[model samples]
Target chain A: MEKEICISELKRLSHLYDIEITVAKKAGRRWSYIVNAGEEKFLPSQIVDQFEGYALFVEGKDFDNEAVVNAFRKIIKKINAQKGG
Target chain B: MITESSWIKKVIKEEEYKKYMNGEKDFINDDEIMQKIEKNKNPDPSKIRNIMKKSLEIQTLSPDETASLLNVTNPLLWEEIYETAAKIKKKVYDNRVVTFAPLYCSNYCVNNCLYCGFRRDNKEEVRRRLTLEEVKRETGVLAGKIGHKRLIVVYGEHPLSDAKYIANTIQAIYSVKAKTKNGYGSIRRVNINAAPMSIEDLSMLKEIGIGTYQVFQETYHHETYKKVHPSGTLKSNYQWRLYSMHRAFEAGVDDVAIGALFGLYDWKFEVMGLLYHAIELEKRFGVGPHTVSFPRLTPAKNAPYVQKTKYKVSDENFKKLIAVIRLSIPYTGLIVTAREPARVRNEVLPMCTQTDASTRIGVGAYSLWGKEKEQKLNRQQFLIGDDRELDTVVRELSEMGYITSFCTAGYRCGRTGKNIMELLKSGKEGSFCKLNAILTFREWLDDFASEETKRAGEKIIKREMEEVKKSATRAYSPQVVEELENYYKRIKNGERDLYF
Candidate 1:
């Protein structure tokens, strides 16, 4: 299921994580968003193809990896609910 | 039609100009730019290496650093700078050259710039604006027959082709779904190269998904700008033109391109001016220009200034300036257009990221191509130096080991504005560039390329696939490789518009 996250929520989460969440066309069966999480804060990161549960897109030794992944999972759940509805 | 004077007055909004200014000043501090050039005249070899290193790190060079690069006189040092420029481009964009076609929509103007064939005073020239239907026709030839996925749609400044007309024309071009060899062809991106527009108009364009809003300051030298553009014209207001990108950003148009006409002033000064422009954009918006163009002076009908200009950039100086630009703003896409001859383009292509091919500059030249074999100078803004067909250019680029890409995926996927800047700086964008180049090249080769071009293109694709496979663990994750291989197979089976 895919949920449409509002732009404001997207911007808020982007600022909170210091990352960019680019809303892309719904490609193929999935992969609607291009979330970037680079080495340093605010650097656009690698392209993640799927947003499955707890899909960690972050890298480097700095951040709390589990915390970020958990947060992303919840966010994806909400978006998916919205999309499915 | 509105009278010329009122139209000019309406277009130059004082608020848009003043909003980006500091007190009474604009960003281009003329004296400071000149002084930087003067002080950095004899740049140390060590200092030059430091600047080049910063560029390799993908940092925007300080004005002083760019000025020092401009002053490097040693041929050996220049060679090193050229090589570094190529390295930086490869690091950021990979070995892909993105191609687009220039579609001039109109030639009517309110400003009588001395260097332009479309200037108001040139009565001998034929003026025409493409109606929406005509725009679609031209787009058909470009997207359907020529297989272009992008365009830099140009327009002269006049009420006839004002913001409303620009918006309608873009929509018309986008509406075209012309038949091709394999599938339907349509322009995925339409970048505008028109005069500076108001915030509201820019918003309208942004809302319509206009690709890049480009405005060349012509020359950043203040006095030269005023002289060439003439007093009492919309374009003469240098502050208005200078603050165009600021207004564009304010209006939510994040993808903006900036440029200067190099022959209007000293090449070194012009290079500094471009650097300053990039710096200002980066400072204010946290994102620099998506592309920088430096079109040197070319002959225009009845425009004697082209020949009379003392500051004309020679071919050697042109290459130097381009390399300097590449090194200075390593993250930005450097464009070297078809305005340059084939030899000059071939020489400079190593450092450039994007260029136009299969270009026709006349008001309605594309639709009128086969009917009129020879170029009619009166209908064109300027004569193009290269008129090679898209097939030849694509084949030649393949031979040079550089894949010709028709990827409009980045813009569509929102890899623009600050996101693009961050990606470019980190050298992460090249991964996307490599994958998209392969996919789009395959699409183009199958759909429209001649047998010769197809052969050349297929060989390059094989090499590129091998590289991707070799770099699987290094450059791309195994999962990403799996997806890429799937997409490649799908495209091979005639599915289209698939990208990473």
Candidate 2:
């Protein structure tokens, strides 16, 4: 069964990672995910691509929570590494 | 002149003040400060050193700790304090001194400040405000010809230089993309040093993407503030000025700067007052000022108080106080402006994060340069002690092994306000700033550097690049390093305004 990823799910995942996620209309009904960590930003698709083979998907209807959390953890690790932590 | 009551009613938004104030209004505890200073007469050297260690960790010192630093008299201990101050600055901000030029938009002041040349009643002073076109022209010279990436635009406390006018002028300055030698140039950041405004008015500035909004409590001593500002004026309300940052934060201004004009009250008390202000802001807003400025009062044409102040800071005491400030608020940037002479500026550069070069305080002075060789005191607020050109100052800094950075990336990249404060305290900001500094230094060197300065600057850039390669590799991802390298190459190839 294909599950549609709503704004609420994405927002919940953002909260879990302590990141800010904003979904805005791109063209008609298409929504873009804007992920913000402090002053840095990453498109949801970009992070999914960075950690390939994670089963994380930004364009699919049913979003996998485990896959989403794994991708977010990778993003947090990269940012923390940049800050020398 | 307009009636005082009418002007006060128009400018002072009482409702805004009441919203932010406590019932008792216990903002500054003057008696408590005096008692603390009196009690911490002789601090143990070992305890003071421990406090210095804490400052090195980028922690804000308590008022008591700062008072002890102010009272230190032993010459050897002072030397250690100065060394630690430099170390702390390097750890947080790196060996880069950010440079900016001051653009005085208008000298038509409403307040009759005792020590200001632009005071309304000064008959000898000529007042003028820059039109939008004139601001564009001045910015052309600063960004295109002089090569400054940031500006601290100063305005007087008058209706003519209100929030609307400031926003229009800021847009004008940003619109200028003047032609440089090999690339285009523009003022990347515009920080305001203007009169405090109501939360509503400050919101207007926030919408325009203003940089740090700075308001100085000229004298933190309430009695001195009253005497200097006079009664029946908007500035006479000390609490309004004290809580200006609170209003700024409410208006969504990310970064706010605070300062005190030295020589007004006891310098020691003034330093303590600044610490208290920082502490109060942190307590109320969860962040302190992004930067702090302490410009010593210099003589003005018709300002008699400038020459006769009993609390005038001596040269030795001035250096000591600046070092103390660096130690007291290790996370906040300390600005030592061109108000001091070149020699004094040279001595204090290591202990400070930013300074102004090629500074002309007179309104429209840059455009009037060829026509007017000397600075007319009647046209400016005060006499600038260091009027050296930008290239000369840059060369001198390079000779001292410090790179003069023109980077304004952090503000644009969302590394400002609370984000920047956290990075600055954790010592992570310097790593990012170092990369940007190298890229911007390359841009400036290719665009505006003189032959001798370019030679000196190249050496510093090479050294900085090596440091970045070594330190940044361990921290940043490989992608960031690749992006930095690409930008470095582009800037070397005459690209301008490149940042990490």
TM-score of 1: 0.89
Report the CA-based lDDT of candidate 1 relative to the real structure: 0.83
iRMSD for every model: 8.1, 9.5
- RMSD for all candidates, in order, please: 5.9, 7.5
- Estimate, for each residue in B97-181, the C-alpha lDDT of model 2 and write its tens digit: 9999999999988888899998878999998999999999999999989999899999998888889999999889988999999
Alpha-carbon deviation at B247 in model 1, angstroms = 0.4
TM-score of chain B of 1: 0.98
Q: On residues B447-481, what C-alpha lDDT tens digit does candidate 1 reach at each position? A: 99999999999999999888887884335756566
Which ten residues in a row are the worst by lDDT in model 2 chain B? B472-481
Which has the greatest lDDT?
Answer: 1
Clashes of each: 3, 3
DockQ of each: 0.11, 0.06
Q: Give the TM-score of candidate 2.
A: 0.87
DockQ leader: 1
